[model samples]
Target: MSYTIPFPRTALLAALGVACLAAGGARADAVPAAQRPVGEVTMSVGPVTRTTAQGLPEMVRRGTPILPGDRLDTADGGHLHIRFIDGALVSIRPGSRMLVEDYKYDPQRVSASLVRFKLEYGVARAISGAAAEGARERFRLNTPLVAIGVRGTDFVVRAGELTTRAAVNQGAIVMAPFGADCTAQALGPCGSSSAKLLSADMGQLQVEFRPQLAQPEIKPLQGAVFATNSTPENGSTVVAARSVAAAPAPAAPALGRTDSERLATAALADGAVTAAISGQAAAPVPPPAVTPPPVVITPPPEPPPVVAVPEPTIPLPPPVLAWGRWAGVAAGDGDIALPRAEAADGRSVTVGNAQYNLYRASDGQTELARGLGSYQFALDKSAAQYSLAGSVSPATVEQGRLLLDFGNARFATDLRVANALTGAVGISGAGAIRGDGIFFDRSVAGQAIAGAAALDGKSAGYFFEKAVGAGTLSGITLWSRP
Candidate 1:
């Protein structure tokens, strides 16, 4: 039987959850309750030492609850100045106070990350890697007013008794919508319980010094103001900008120089005053420029809390991919780079000295037609289809375990290949072909697997007519999950 934790996905628990503590409820539930990983996790604080339960590097000693003083850092050199660790680097500036429930990372599984932190009153910066491929690694911030879930790339959080604000800097994220739990059926994306109040409850949450949006962690430009402004007009609030004008020469030095030049040989003959003038003739070398001291930011005694609100209903549009790129070694064999397409009213796209006709057919199949001396070649497919066909014979489908075939050519399909959404390819009276994973051609001789599958083809069992020729696969990069 599957062990499931009775955790609430709603928002009512966002505030005042500290009173509802349970053994392993928050921490373990963050990792699906049942999945416990065996690995080394550390939390480091300050410059000198590392410790546990006390001091800087807190060990998170088994049963002990992580309190206000502890900070965490991981083996991958990730710095966690505050909060939990789900690849979310929470650097709390000064007086921020928060509670950490759990953090887990599993490199083996693409989605084995789960992190949760509850901000009571503080300023926190979160540089995140959330929902990033593996299991259910999520970064959550619990404020006095609401809960903030990051279904996004990166953002910053600041919350307090009077106010809570979360600003997204990169990628996308969402605060589970309010009023979500109003109905027993479903509240859609945001429920009434999911609505979070921002710019509220934050009494003295100053934006100064606290980075609302992130800044690159490099040595900031010295002798210049470290300013940050929202609009181009607000400019940066000068963290520090020092302009030291070159030192001026003493007035006596200039007069003394003119006198010394006049004294010269005559002074030796004439006598004393000339020697005095000569002795005073030198201009003191300007003291070597003092390297300005490193600026230290003394955080406020009290920092604000951070919370997130539901994103707007109309989500942003996706970017368009213009397949105008040409891929081929400078002096080697090459074919059209993939998502192999077919055409309708197409144009000639040149690669090397030759040009291939690219067509976006009305039926959505992409086609590539190129002439090579006596033989004319073409490959056609809708970028979504798992099947493809060449101008040659015997059409091929995805090989399921890993690979795509076209006679003798085999291309790695594990990550490099993307299943097409529409269209088909036909080379007529060819032989048998077999495969899986969105396979639309024939059947595979072996196993078949897909995150999701869709296949349609006919032959003896899969597809068999002529004697299948060669089998080959090529050109694709594997995307890893850690």
Candidate 2:
């Protein structure tokens, strides 16, 4: 016999409550409620994954909250687009790994904002937003080879363990290699002597930084660097002439019997015909030989009257110039002969060294298709220059359009530029195109206008400057065919 001691129901309930609390505490530790989200995934495709600061792995999707210290890894065909709280945009390409090292922003206190990002490998395009624009000095993008600092810019960068390549679509950027003078702890762009500046006005130039090189080198724009604009392995923005419509389903193929079946059917038909012929009664002999009908001859109908049809005249396409960048190459140089040169003037423009010579395209052909068309400003590749509190800042191009008469080689523009901190200005200009597809004039409403049509004649870029108040406003404009 055993004596039983009564247990309170309250004690049993308390024991179960303790176990549930322990389990819930563990989950809370994985994702802290105190940690604030820094950004959100606006677009995601393919196999993109994110690792949280506490080492929790999550599949990325649209609307995924991006917390600071979280690392993103994109698989072979993955792409991720993120929009930060401050309105900055960053797109990560396939096989890429990126981390938001640090971010801090306050709309009320704009000057104190700080933004930084690290690209471990692969490619990405960064478009500066409010935080970067408000505090340019405090913003930075770190890569393996260099640290990129923006000046109100939109740029693409490819980073690897040994090298880094950058191209600016709008505004400018300064890149400096990691060295004794430039440390990783620094914010914004490094101000070392090795720092090199690249601006949109440089005419399609890219900057490459390598560990072996003393300074970043300027290079011709590489088509591969601009592959983001093309349809990528994952879903990114695709450039197309027209929108594609959904296609209808194809009709089913007509049904038919196989060769073997047809042969068998033919054999049976032949057997039936032979049996019928053999079973038929014999026919009577013909009554007599019938008289033949009279033969008749008729001439062929007269041929249709010949008519000469003149062929439609077709116009030949205009000559297209090939563009390039020459460094340390001489004039009429065999290694780098001037493209489409009629004859070298023997006089070359020298920039730095006496060995280098640049052949002006003014002497080359620039005839293009004749038509009156309009070009809209590409804000992604356009920027305005202004000063904010005596420091150089990027101004906004509110609206701009160019009306060009290709037949007459004349152009007119209506552009409006403004700065939040400064005043806005409306600019109008008219110019005549040159034989080389260049347009230039010293004074357009007291401003200078100079630009040239692109090699394909579908785009144009120019630099503008004007005196405003006590300072000056200078900027670059990139226009595309509408």
Candidate 3:
């Protein structure tokens, strides 16, 4: 029933040629809950959901069941594994979310029997471990409206209500409707023979598909920006998505006075919502810095009435230590990998993996940093240089996790725009704000800023815990712009 083909030397080399990545890795995110596989509960929050032995991860909680949205996090080296009630495994990275509506496992045959996950925002890698190709126990994922038919292949989906981006890392993932008869839904040019589903150049909301398009960049029919170069067999076409997932924030938030919070808010601001589900909120703002008052000493009452005790001077909020949110970070990549970054001003710097000589953004001619560890410089209102050093602090929840010295922004760069950093407790990344936008470019030898990832209407929060199962997990390298 299966067939295989051998390739000639020329053909084989040609095939490998196209496989090379021009630059970037993948612009994606992952769901902490639904991304994990079941057999081994890789990650967990609480009682919300679990990756069943043969089930995909599910949305355990939303903001209070219906109020606010809950956020999950991961990094590059991290992934959220989910199990399909039928025995499927899904892996998600740092920035991802899923809304679960219905799922029933028929362990007898190992299938979704019936399964669905609404990828509201972020990225997800789904692998069908058990569901048979043509068997009725099909595994499927839905955006607001359109549906995706996930085969045994490994597919990572980045979705928004109007614009869903589906890229196949290993196998092909077909998009169809929920419960629609596979054969009955005779798509005109269904397979690779039909051509590319769309071109890579298609705008966010205006992607057109053709048979010639490459396999890896095949974005299914969920995003609002889809175009039909050719007609389908169905006389009347179904518009597909009920609504878009979310719109992308502009460029990175500018580094300035407004971005002092902690968490970085993204997603939610990009697409529209379809069904009701719980997910993470925007990154939260950092708690305002509380500087302890200077110690004051009172002199003992002297016998002489003329002798007066001197009062201690309370130093004003050290302009340098007056902490508040700086302007937003440039729209950064969910998979940012920057070398040493020079702060906005020529004199300041922020630390990174690589080393570099940076010219300050605030002043075009000044080279504020060079001979130092990976560091970025910033300028607030001063003639002083502050460095945002990157390092793992033993006393941090995000410890070992990459942390940015936000102070570098104000003192170094002249922000064109900015967003707020949200957080809770001592440190949290939740909430929404505005920003100039930022992103990473993998094309360069040392990955650098390719563009920006604006975070206008998202949020962040910190609920660090392992309530699900495995309490020991290496957080993902997802946001390690490090």
Worst 10 residues of 1 by lDDT: 452-461
Summarize candidate 2's per-residue lDDT along 85-114 as a digit string, tens digits. Answer: 777778888888998988877789888988
After superposition, the stretches of candidate 3 with alpha carbons farther than 4 Å from their true spots are: 1-40, 44-79, 110-112, 132-137, 176-482
- Give me the runs in candidate 2 sitting further than 4 Å from their true place: 1-34, 226-482
Residues 1-482, model 3: lDDT tens digits? 11111222234233223221111224312423233222232343333342333444455422112111223333334445444334445554444556444443445655335455567655665655444343433555655423566544555555543234554434445553222222322321223211233322332221221111111233233321211122231112445668767987789967765563554565433322322233545444556799999999988886766767799888863111111112233212321122322123222221111112111122222222222122222211111111113321111122222222322321111112111211111211212111222212122121112111112101111111111111111011212122
- C-alpha lDDT of candidate 2 relative to the true structure: 0.66
Alpha-carbon local distance difference test for all models: 0.31, 0.66, 0.31
lDDT of 1 by residue, 1-482 (tens): 22111222122123112232223555765753323431212233332122333445543322223342333323322222422223334444334455554455555553656565566654555555433324322445555644555444444555555334454444433443112232212211233322332221232221211111111111122211111112121122334668999998767733345665767564232234555677754443456789999999997787566678878799763211112222332112223223223211232211100111122111222221222111111122212112125422222333222233333322222212322332232222112122321122212322121110111111001111111223222221111111
- Residue 287 lDDT in candidate 1: 62
Best by lDDT: 2
Error of 1 at 16 (Å): 31
